[model samples]
Target: MSKVIVLTGAGGVLCSTLAKALAKEGHKIAVLDLRKDAADAVANDINKEGGKAIGVAANVLKKDSLEEAKNEINNTLGTVDILVNGAGGNHPLGTTSNPHFLKEDLLNKDEGFKTFFDLDSEGIEFVFNLNFIGTLLPTQVFAKDMVGKKGCSILNISSMNAFTPLTKIPAYSGAKAAVSNFTQWLAVHFSKEGIRVNALAPGFFLTDQNRTLLTNNDGKLTARGTTIINQTPMGRFGEPEDLIGTTLWLCSEGASFVTGVVVPIDGGFSAFSGV
Candidate 1:
C-alpha cells in the first residue's frame, strides 16, 4: 500500500536517509528542508530510483513558511499520511564550557561567555523554540489531515541528550527533553484520533552538522567523540542507516499499538552507567 509521507529537514543527513528508505517502500514523500537545493537533491535522487517525491523548502521556525510547505505537500502528495518532525539542532552560543558555573568566570568577559554563566538568554530561547515549538507547529499544521486516517503516525527526532544532559549543551538537552515530553503528550492527546506519535532518539551519528565537533578533518573521532564511543556498549558511532529499521517499523502497520514512546537508536549508550 502506497502512503504519503512528509519529512521535515529532509536535507539533513538522517532525514534524507529516512526519506529515501520510505520512498523505497513505495511511499510518496514530501521532502522539506530549510535549504532548497539539498531538499531538491534528495527528492531528485528518490525520483531517479523510481519513487515519487517532491522537494519543499520550509523554515520550521516560521509559521507561514511551514504553511506554504504544507500546501505544497497537500497539492503534490495528497496530504501527509506520515509526519516526521526532523527539523531541530543546537546553537554554539547556547552552550557552556563546563557543566557548572564558577564565580571567577563571571568577572572575566572571555571566560564568562565560555562558562555556564555565559549562556545567552536569546540563544537558549532559540534552541527551545527550534526543537519544541518547531515540532509542535508542524504537528498543528499537518496532523489535521491525519485525523481518522488509519496507520498514520508521527516520528520526532530526539537526541541522547534528552535522556540526560550532556556537558556544554544545556539548551539543546533541555529542548530535546521537551520534545520527548511532547511526544508522549501528543500521543495521548491524539489517541482517539487514530494517530500515533513517537520519537527516535539517536545516540550519535556523524553528520555535517556535528562533523567538526565529533571528528577531525581526517575523519577520526575527536577526544570528546571518542569518549562517547567508548561509553557505548557497541563501541562505535551510529551511522544514518542504523535508524532506518525503527523508522520503517513505526511507519508501517507493525507499530499500530506503539505510541508515546522514545525509541533510542543508540548502541546501548543510554543503557550504560559507565561502570
Candidate 2:
C-alpha cells in the first residue's frame, strides 16, 4: 500500500538512503532536514527515479519548526503514516578525550585535552536536546494525525551507545538511552491508537560525519575504529544499505505485529563480550 512518510534528517547518510528506498517503494515521502540544500538534493534524486518526494527544511530542536514541516508534509502528501526520527549526532565539544579522567587533569588549567570534567554544560545540553527532544517534538507534531490510523508507525534512530554508554560521548549515550526509553513509553501510550513506536540501534556505520574520526587520510580505519571492528562479532563496519532491509520490514505489513522494540542492525556488536 502506498503510504505517506515523514523522514527527519533526510539529508544525512542513513536517512537519505531510507528516504530513497521508501520512495522507490512508491511511498509519498517528505524529506526534512536542517540543511535545505541537502534535503532538496535527496528529494530531487527520488524524483529523478520517478518517485514521489517533497523536501522540507526544519530544525528538529524547535517545536514550531517541526510543526511547520508537518504542515508542509500534510499539504503536499497527506497525513504522515510513518515517521523516522533520524536527526541526531555527536558534537566534538560534548565529547571527552577519554572515558575517565584523573584528579590532576580536572585540576589542570590547561585547555589542551577535554576530559569529562572539561565537558561544557552547553555542549551537553545541545546534544541532549538534539537527540532526545528532537525525537519528541517531531512525534508530537506528526502523530496527531496518525492516531487510530492503521499502519501508522514511528521509528527512532538509537545507537549502540544507548545500550552501553560509549566512551568519550557521555551526553550522546545518555540522550540515546532516553530515546530508547521514550520509544517504549510512546509505543505503549499509543498502542490503543494503532500507532506503533520502535527504534533502530545502529552500531558503527562510517558516515560522512564520522569518516574523518574513524578513518585516516589514507582511508584506513583509525585505531579507535579498528577497536570497534575488533569488538564486533562480524569484524566489519556497516554500510548504509545494511539498514534498508530492517527499515523496510518495520515499515511494511510484515512487521505489523512488532512494536516497542529496539532492533539492532549492529553486526552483533550489541551481543559481543570482549573476552
Candidate 3:
C-alpha cells in the first residue's frame, strides 16, 4: 500500500537517497529542507523518475514553519503516514580540535587547536537543538495526523555516537543520544495511539555535512576518517543505499511491533569492541 511520507533534510546526500528510494516504492514523498532549491532539486529528481513528491522549504527548528509545511503536505499529498526527522547537523563551534584533552593545548595559540573549554556555547546549543529539538518539532507537527492511524510511523536520524561518544564531537554525541532516548520515550508514549516512533543510528556515511571534515580535498581520508575506517570491522564506510532496506522495513507492516529501537546502519561499527 502506498503512503504519504515526509522526509526532512531530504536535500542532503543520505536523506535524498532515502527520499528517492521510498518514492520508488510507490510512496508520495514530501522532500523538505531548509533551502528551497535543495528541496526542489530532490523533489524534481523523484518526480522525473515517475514518483510522487513535492519540495517544501522549511526550518525544522521552527514550529510555525513545520505547521505550515504540514498544511501544504496535507493539502497536496494527503495526511502524512510516515515522518522522517533527518534534519540535523554538527557545528564547528561544538567540536574540539584534539580528541583528548592536553594541558599544553590550552596554552597553544594554534588556529586549529580547540580544547573542550574553548567550545562555544552557541555552537554546542546549535548542534544540540538541531538534532534533538529539530526532531521534536517535526514530530509535534506531523505525528498529529498519525494519531489513531495505522500504518503510520516516525523515523529519526541518530548517530552511533549516541551509543558511545566519539572523539571531538561532544555536542553532536549528546544531541543524538537525546534523539535515541526520545525515540524510546516516544515509542512507549505512543504505543496505544497507533503512532510508532523509532530512530536510525547511522555509524558513518560520508555526507556533504561531514565530507570536508572526514576527507581532505584530495579525497584522502583525514586522521579522524582513517581512525573510523580502521575501527570499522567492515573496512569501508556505509553507502546511502545501505539504509533503504532497514528504512523500508521499519516503515512497513513487517515492523508493526518494532518501535523505539535505534537500528545502527553502520557496517558493524557498533558491534565490534575493537579488542
The best candidate in terms of lDDT: 3
- CA-RMSD of model 2: 1.2
The 10-residue segment with the lowest total lDDT in model 3: 105-114
RMSD in order of candidates: 1.5, 1.2, 0.9
Task: Residues 177-265, candidate 1: write the lDDT tens digits.
Answer: 99999999999999998899999999999888788998898989888898898899999889999999999999999999999999999
TM-scores for all predictions: 0.96, 0.97, 0.98
> Candidate 2 has what TM-score?
0.97
lDDT of 2 by residue, 1-275 (tens): 99999999999999999999999899999999999999999999999999999899999989889888988888889988999999998888899886678777776666657988678899999999999999999999999989868999999999999899988899999999999999999999999888889999999999988899889999898989988989999989899999999999998888988899999999999999898
Query: What is candidate 2's CA lDDT for residue 8?
Result: 95
Off by over 4 Å in 3: none
Task: Give the TM-score comparing model 3 with the true structure, all chains together.
Answer: 0.98
Model 3 residue pairs with clashes:
none
Q: Write down the worst ten-residue block by lDDT for model 2.
A: 103-112
Clashing pairs in 1: none
lDDT by residue (tens digit), candidate 3, 1-275: 99999999999999999999999999999999999899999999999999999999989999999999999999999998999999999999999988899788879898867899999999999999999999999999999999878889999999999999999999999999999999999999999887888899998899888888789999999998998999899998899999999999999999999998999998899999888
TM-score of 1: 0.96
